[model samples]
Target: MGAYISTFPTGFAGLIPTALQKLLPGAQVVQVYDGLVHYRYGGKPGDLGKVFLFHNTFLVLREFQGPASQMDSMVRSAAGIKSLPPSRGSFRVRYSVKNQFVAVPKERTRQLEGKIAALTHAKVDRVSPDTEYWFLQRSEGVGFFCRLLGRRQATERDLHPGELRPELAYLMASLAKLGRDSVVLDPFAGYGAIPKQVLGYFPYAMVLVSDLDRDRAVDLRASLGGKRGVSVAQRDALTLEGIPGATVDAIITDPPWGYYEEIEDIQVFYRGMFASFRRVLKPRGQVVLLSARKREAEAAAQEMGFPLRQRYDTLVNGKKAAVYLLEVGPAL
Candidate 1:
């Protein structure tokens, strides 16, 4: 059976299996090695699982762990030989190790490689092998598993100040139901974390990134670079009158919550955001919002003629955070 491999965030590995089910319907989840899950299926899947070739696998390992010591060890293991040339039919091992823990031992790898070679009578070269014997190491533990092809690395970028974490970005992207062509707009695009993440998955889609502070907007633009087709603007998110009407597909943002300033008019700001969102987003388009004030956000959406579609519980710095998905009202 044609097989493939996938990787996900450390604690969020559970989401990968769910995503794979959606991407490759009826595909058997033959093996799950810690963070890497192996699937036996036919055709290639979509971007939901960062699919990768041999070269891409090498790049991902180098980027994630640097130097690829684990990969080298796997090459010398006897099991490596049994998985010769790394094809879909070959058996391979995949796992994750703690980033700070003891580095993988070369002797252990050599013994594994020798065993595989003896069993299969094949030479092992882990670097360019097609069989994806992958390793993932986080702060907690190591995971090992294998499949026919290695998947791509999860999205990685320089996070902006006051931006949500990478894990949150992944969750937001998935929760937003973003398609390959879905246009994403981030009004309070502080440092452009959400937009950058959206672009990472949907590079060709339109992204409207805006922030009130001009300097922050400039920084966001610089971080985003000029390569991706992104449009940057400096404007007040609360009053999005400057933005064109009926121009957005989905609104996904982490708006400012009154924490330090204890602003008296917090409700007004939320109402404005809701009104602007209703004005710009398409009828079927939705808004996925991350907010500290769940009740306030829900109330604003209701007042603005929007309906709450879904809500997800998230954590920020060990504190409770809520993610809301809303759809525009019929009158809008």
Candidate 2:
């Protein structure tokens, strides 16, 4: 089986391996470069989006030299200038230039595009929503990949600003290991993106979503609720009323990012959230949270006794952020 190349957001490279380990266990995962992973399963892994923000996955036909020799390698690897096909679709060629292929001239880039067109026997349509091909300039060489899945819609969904992205949401859910019959909660379920993605990825898990914004909560409660096993309500994260202590299997939440909620004391806000999560989560249960503000979140987590179990450096809206998985307490 030819390896499939999965691409992710720049800083989210850490999530690729973790998600693949869980979903495609026993499959070989090679981090060929930053933001890229090469893996091959025995059989087709249906719906790769269930794992996380996989920008796209493609079948690698060949790997060879970058820049000066990239075009030659691609042309030859794809069979040295194939004859034109009568009804061939367009191709979106992605040229990834880094250290190896730096200082290239504009003429070289244009030449590479021409080479790609020749290989596909089709036009290089950057605008057309068509078959895609990726070229990465690596230290070893420039790897060429033919797009198999043109569009990976797992992370592309209706979401509000400041709401958690579906890609990140899936990652958070996967970290919790939530599955069939599990009672999972998203305390600050803004616009319900968290629950929506969770349901889409792990349909069997029982999701309890709560949001403070009454209007958004109502809409999400109507739309994001009533899936295979989903419930939604308007509730405050600081006070998870009617929820008993130590009952929740996991709490995966994206708390207010300070800018959207206009929080005066973000530290105090974070501390309250941690305390609430600590109350509802069962012993050894996990709390996965993402925030752009690092210092405040780190301080509050430490003070509230939620030590970090896993951390992924991330980017949100072009700002630095991180995903934290915190353990409840000492394991039984």
Candidate 3:
């Protein structure tokens, strides 16, 4: 079986591998290009937002005036191409023709549906019934992949307090691979976007969300009530031991990057955070952090015996963001 993986710009691609590793574990990543990647899985695709939690990787289908080989080659030349495994297979491809100006035109959408029928040698009436045909798009082109399809809810536009953007929520959810029985923690839970996404997947797992801002903490509590097993507290990051020991399983946090120099002393903040993370995390718990200053995070983690597992770059709110995965000392 095949599955599609989508990522945002830069470090977004990094989120995909971590999510894939956690959810699809041993599955091979078979192909990748631009905004889309394919994974080979033996079992049915897991419930991404409900049961088997995994990141939402978009299946973008672009329509180009040029040949498919040209599109493939152009994508191969992009910077993050190295993250994907080499491509070698004859998979079915789908394309549609229409005015490429307006967004997701229904006429074009129908035309694409007809193409899938022709490719599979199925009749036009059977196209709608087919379980295959994954759809994705960008500004310049559209692409279609034939595979099992699942529709995601339209992305929410309203921003919660302190949420930088919707993409950050997506990134956090993708990084944690939040699913059933997965406990998630966000020490710097600004408006609780990270915990919110985690609970979206595993409603049963206890989510611990804390923030320095009391009002934001209150907002998060109101936003997540009765949706998941949630606990919210107003506390500074330096003083987070109020929570019980070894209580959290995974952490997906975007700490203050100090871009505006709001964090007066960056090193001190890192030192305190490292200590706090070590105190609360279980031996096998993983930390996925997004920061602009990679060196600071890397140095602090090293000093505190947290091994840096991997790093990726992605654009967050049009700014370059670095994402890192850290595991407790000397194990992985």
Point to the candidate with the largest lDDT: 2
- Model 3: which ten-residue window has the lowest total lDDT? 78-87
Measured with C-alpha atoms, the lDDT of residue 30 in candidate 3 is 57
Candidate 1 has an lDDT of 0.61
Give me the runs in candidate 3 sitting further than 4 Å from their true place. 1-9, 12-30, 37-157, 160-171, 177-182, 330-332
For model 2, residues 248-269, the per-residue Cα lDDT tens digits are: 8888888887976689999999
Cα lDDT listed for each candidate: 0.61, 0.71, 0.58
How far is 226's C-alpha from truth in model 2 (Å)?
2.6
TM-score for model 3?
Answer: 0.59
Alpha-carbon runs more than 4 Å astray in model 1: 1-15, 18-161
Predicted candidate 1 versus true structure: per-residue lDDT over 143-236, tens digit per residue = 3333323334432344434667655665676677776676778888886767866776543367788888889889877877474657887888
lDDT of 3 at 62: 29
Which numbered prediction scores highest in TM-score against the true structure? 2
Off by over 4 Å in 2: 10-33, 41-52, 65-87, 90-94, 99-120, 124-133, 139-142, 145-158, 179-181, 203-205, 330-332
Please provide the root mean square deviation of candidate 3 (C-alpha atoms, Å). Answer: 10.2
* lDDT accuracy of residue 51 in candidate 1: 32
